[model samples]
Target: MHPALVEEFKSVDAVIASDARTAGVDAFALSLLKVERQARRFVTYLVFQYPCFGRSDVPALRKTLSDSKKVYFEGILRGFDALYPQPLEALIGAEYAHLKARVDEAELHRNKLFHGQLTEESLSRAQLLEFVVDMRRWCELLCDAGQQELGYAGFGSSSFTKSPELTMSASFRIQMQGLADYDAFIKTVLRRPQGQQAQ
Candidate 1:
């Protein structure tokens, strides 16, 4: 995994267990947003076939997904849906409805938190942390799906694993097949209609 993600994994561990409830709330909320952004970046990478090695600051990705206002999580979902319109089990041997559900659920809390309207009654620390953890799991599931269906040579999958230790033990490397052939394959996939790409 990248150094920044390694540090973020450690920070999340601390916030999840921290006794500083007030600060933990802010940290957890911010972490939730980070997870959402990471999900968007993954979708962007899959669309453009870019391997970013777990970083989210890619210029081309930002430019592609840029909007006058903030990009909506559902908007990213629409692009992903367009890319893979078939039932996931038909392609990746998995069901991803849960991933979409998790994203939708997180969006609700995300809006409330960002607007400073989320309260203890509406979303407790335990609930907030649950969303963060679940969203992280969502990212991991998507990564696994990408590798299974697209033959993507990704190594950062371990960075999303759950652990109790605050150490960055996950080692990751980004790999790709022949650059020319891969580029052609991505172009072919983009050209085909939804669910009609040759496997």
Candidate 2:
């Protein structure tokens, strides 16, 4: 995905996740679904954002993403390493498989979700937050890798550091494109929890 699209995904994911987090503990199952949906949509966006995806695959990819279908999802995840610069190959090669495994493990929850087999209490709030934080970290790592591929900016030790924090404000704004604002948005989304994770 282009750097802009990657950033766009981050903004939208935070917004959606924040909204879902507003639900009381009674709806934690739904909260899991919301995060799962965002992750699915994110991978779909990456596929469509690819310069060649529009040739005919965009719609099918969108469908797969919308439905959270794992089989075809694997296809969309492919070739990401190819888009990066040669130097980035060394960086991404080791991590790409690991990222895929993380995504797959999360997506695997969808089946239990669909069959009404997953209990609301299956995981604690803290555990759910960890899943999201992990997924967000995955997203950030990919975006940083994408940036490295294009040589758009210098590498920073703490790029997209917000992935570890689970709390999100309902009124948070999306900062598109400008480097400073984008950086701030990341900080805001990732701000450390005052006490417990999530609102």
Question: Which regions of candidate 2 fall more than 4 Å away from where they truly are?
Answer: 1-71, 79-98, 119-121, 151-199
Candidate 1: tens digits of C-alpha lDDT, residues 38-154: 545544445444332234434433443352233455544444454444433344234456655665676666566667775436667776677666656555555456555543312
129 Cα displacement, candidate 1 (Å):
2.2
TM-score of each: 0.55, 0.41
For residue 112, what is the lDDT in candidate 1? Answer: 67
lDDT of 1: 0.48
Angstrom error at residue 102, model 2? 2.7
Mind sharing the TM-score for model 2?
0.41
> Which residue pairs collide, candidate 2?
none
Task: Tell me the alpha-carbon RMSD of every candidate.
Answer: 11.0, 16.4
Backbone clashes counted, model 2: 0
**TM accuracy, model 1:** 0.55
The segments of candidate 1 whose C-alpha lies over 4 angstroms from its true place after superposition are 1-8, 50-61, 67-70, 85-95, 151-199
Could you give candidate 2's per-residue lDDT for residues 1-199 as a string of tens digits? 4454345445445554565553223233333443344333433332233333343554454443344322233332322222222332254467656655655665565445556677445765555555555555555554555455432221232222222222221112231323343233223332333454211
